[model samples]
Target: METWGFEASNVAVAQVRIEQQLVEAATRAGLTNLRVTTDSEVETIGPTQWLGAEVQANLLWTPTFAFLDALAAWPEGFRVTGFQYEMQPLTPLQQEAGMTAPTGSVRIGVAFPVILPPTAAAPAAAGAGS
Candidate 1:
């Protein structure tokens, strides 16, 4: 069994919505059997929220091929700032046993830069301004 890993970053404000859409898109693109695991952290940068996340999905097909197809079919409104793929080889014992590994497993994670949004800056008093 081949495993595929996907990492998406710099998402939009509607992170959850977009994530769901992406999953649907993947399913429509012939990746039906999908298992999803997700984690997220929020951060604030000035007014805008800078959020980052990593999503890993194991495909039933070849890892590289599935990843490429998924990447190509990714919907708009979501920018994939970064991505990576790794091939995890099966153990010798498992190979000897002639057992096929499970496929279509997905893991999603998010890492935000700032947890809390910054409050409004305090105004300076007249004396302080002087």
Candidate 2:
């Protein structure tokens, strides 16, 4: 195999897309100097859910007063969950698990993402249940 300039995983791609969306929205809304990033891992979430997918977005910026006020009052699904930051910088186990095949190892995490919309999820959910 080959390791080029970072071949992003499914979750990574999703995170990047989400980041872009947020950034674009913020930019359009006239927010400045904000940075958003996301990453996912289930094993470290505790209680180990095989079918669970968790995404963590780190918003690293102290917004201006106007930006904050605008963000608070703005509508149209900001969906930030929370404003406070969480410290989830990739554990060693997670790094190891990501690098290896999951046949004989044990670092529990979600293998695939489960996205929304009844139409889109129907087929995949049905197949998965079977």
Most accurate candidate by lDDT: 1
Per-model TM values vs. the true structure? 0.39, 0.32
Alpha-carbon RMSD to native, per candidate: 11.5, 16.8
RMSD of 1: 11.5
Look at candidate 2 and give me any clashing residue pairs.
Answer: none
Question: Residues 33-86, candidate 2, lDDT per residue (tens digit)?
Answer: 455544442111122111232222223233323334444453322223333433
Which pairs, if any, clash in model 1?
A: 37-108, 43-114
Q: 118, model 1: CA deviation in Å? A: 16
Over 62-92, each residue of candidate 1 has an lDDT whose tens digit, in order, gives 5434544665654331234444434466778
How good is model 1 by TM-score?
0.39
